[model samples]
Target: MTERQQQRSPSSGAGAAPAPPPGDADAESGPTVLGFAPDTAEDDETVEPVADGTAARVAVGSDRLAYVRRPDLVGGLLLLLAGVADAASVWLPWDRDGDVSGLSLVVRAVDAAPEGIAELGRTGLWQPAAVAAGGVVLLVLGLLLLRPARGHRVSGVLALGVALAVAAAVVGRLVDVGWDARSFGPGAWCAVAVAGLGALGALKAVLTAPRVTTVPAERLLVG
Candidate 1:
């Protein structure tokens, strides 16, 4: 061969590099950014995941948990009724004052001179006010009991205190005003009944534990 041809021979420095081995693709590809595996053009198949319906079940279970259950519902409804009855008691005639209803008591108290907490108490409408306040609180508590995740223990305890206060207020009023009770109106009886019912509801709420969320194992796993 001539000198120029000899220079281009296979053993010469200018000879093209030997072809790389076929199985060493890993060596040919460098590490990707963010430590991700490098994507290869050969990976064109789309993987269709199996539809297990687990996610749907999990969602349903969570949604159900948002509402109060049957036992709580009944109790809550009773409490609501109790609150309404007691509140109405404040409007109806509790005792006979020349055939006047207790509803007039507030107006009369506002106009009367200070009379301390003895006969009618310093605040003439203390008992009625208590009944009204307690009833309102009970009503709100009852409604709260109908919802989920309200910390039932705390709400129940609060309701219990309110119920007891109302009961005491009603009893004290009866004792104070009973001597003059020529004719007790339906309001008086209604107040007592509602207070009793409210107390029961409060006690029930205090004693009961909240329901735990239940979901299928598969749903939990999916979630």
Candidate 2:
């Protein structure tokens, strides 16, 4: 065979297939064992990473109780004292005439009437009992506020409402019998002062209570 012809022979590799383009190399090659591709769903829903130290600071479950403040402590004590004093006032002299006590009023009404319990409202003597009950409710709410909890604001509000209601009842009694100091017995004066002070303490507690929030653990740590 001629030299040129020999060089051009197909068996002699005169012409070989052109190399595959870089983009098509994979297709030409057999199936490749690719490295792991992370889940796209997780990638799409990615959260910003938090620091390890910050993650450790997050509180959980009941451990997330709100921080108590100085005002809460002080106000709670005041309300407790006011509650005790107000409740005790029910046994003291309520009127100038006959020195009728709250308990005495109930007893006399029961002794004189067939429906003594029902007569309480009609004679307006139920005010003292109602005030006493209100004082008790204030005491409970005050006790709750004394502890660190998420319900501080709610307790404070309840306390304030009860205190205000008691104060209003005391004022109503004073108005009914004329506001003269001589018209008030020790019990009446005590009720008035205790109600006023209880209301003020409740107001302070409500205003100073911290707002409680529920957030993700990560967010709590970040904050």
Which stretches in model 2 have alpha-carbon errors above 4 Å? Answer: 1-71, 106-121, 209-223
- The estimated TM-scores of all candidates read 0.57, 0.57
- lDDT by residue (tens digit), candidate 1, 116-176: 4454565446666667667888899899888866446777788888888878877777677
Q: Lowest-scoring 10 consecutive residues by lDDT in candidate 2?
A: 54-63
Clashing pairs in 2: none
Give residue 171's lDDT in candidate 2 (0 to 100): 72
lDDT of 2 by residue, 13-125 (tens): 64777666998766646544464434433321333446563323332333344433433677788788877777667788877665787667546645546667567656666
